[model samples]
Target: AAVPWPEVYGAGGDSPGGAGRPTRGAGALVVVQDGRLLAHLTRGGRSVLLFSRPTMGDEDGPGATDPADVQAVVTVLSSLISVGRLSPVTVEKVNGTEVMSLGAGTRAWTEAGARFTPKGLVVR
Candidate 1:
């Protein structure tokens, strides 16, 4: 099923001119990596991620506990939790994929607005 999306605005919150509307219920994501606009991924069926070429600063990691990044994630998580949704917390580790203590569906259900999930230790 094809979704619909609104016209993506530019730095001034206006259309980028001759911009085509994307499928809705799809990519409305606001992925902000290191104070830069990385991508706006979708969250529905067969969701896809859309990105931009022009970026700012080096493509370096935001380091664990990044101020801006952390604030963004926490803001999103806090809103969800306040609405009786799911709880979310970032986990720090060296080299291992952290298992979501809340289970797969718990966090994977981002489509249902269940974003921001609490991650457990990355035990290998």
Candidate 2:
């Protein structure tokens, strides 16, 4: 069975242009490498990631961001924070290049270190 789009959006309706509407119930894996934090969100077979620099603080650093993307990133961040997976100490560790992974659907930071990916993140 397919979920209706309206149900996904709740009572917000179809307003991608509206203020940042935090996403809910989406499974996400947050990976921190170097100064960047990448959150991979998956729900109903769809997946997208939002990347930002933890070292950048509240200022914009890098990554693509239209209004919708901003909202999505905000949603992911909100979720992470609410679950205690994101915090200043965590961000500092990430900025220091300590590898970290927050398992999807869980609030725990399962692994943290530099030896896990000494060569750094690889994309192929």
Tens-digit lDDT track for model 1 on 12-122?
Answer: 222212223333453244446566643332342122122342124342211111234334433554565477654333332111112242233123223324343344321
Candidate number of the best lDDT: 1
Identify the runs in model 1 with alpha carbons over 4 angstroms from their true place: 1-62, 88-124
Candidate 2, run of 10 with poorest lDDT: 105-114
Instruction: Give one clash count per candidate, in the order shown.
Output: 9, 0
Per-residue lDDT of candidate 2, residues 1-124 (tens digit): 1532212221232222221222456443443444444444433212333343222233222222233333444455555556876531222112112223211211112212112233332111
Cα displacement (angstroms), candidate 1, residue 91, comes to 3.8
lDDT of 2 at 43: 38
Model 2: runs farther than 4 Å from truth? Answer: 1-64, 88-124
Best by TM-score: 1
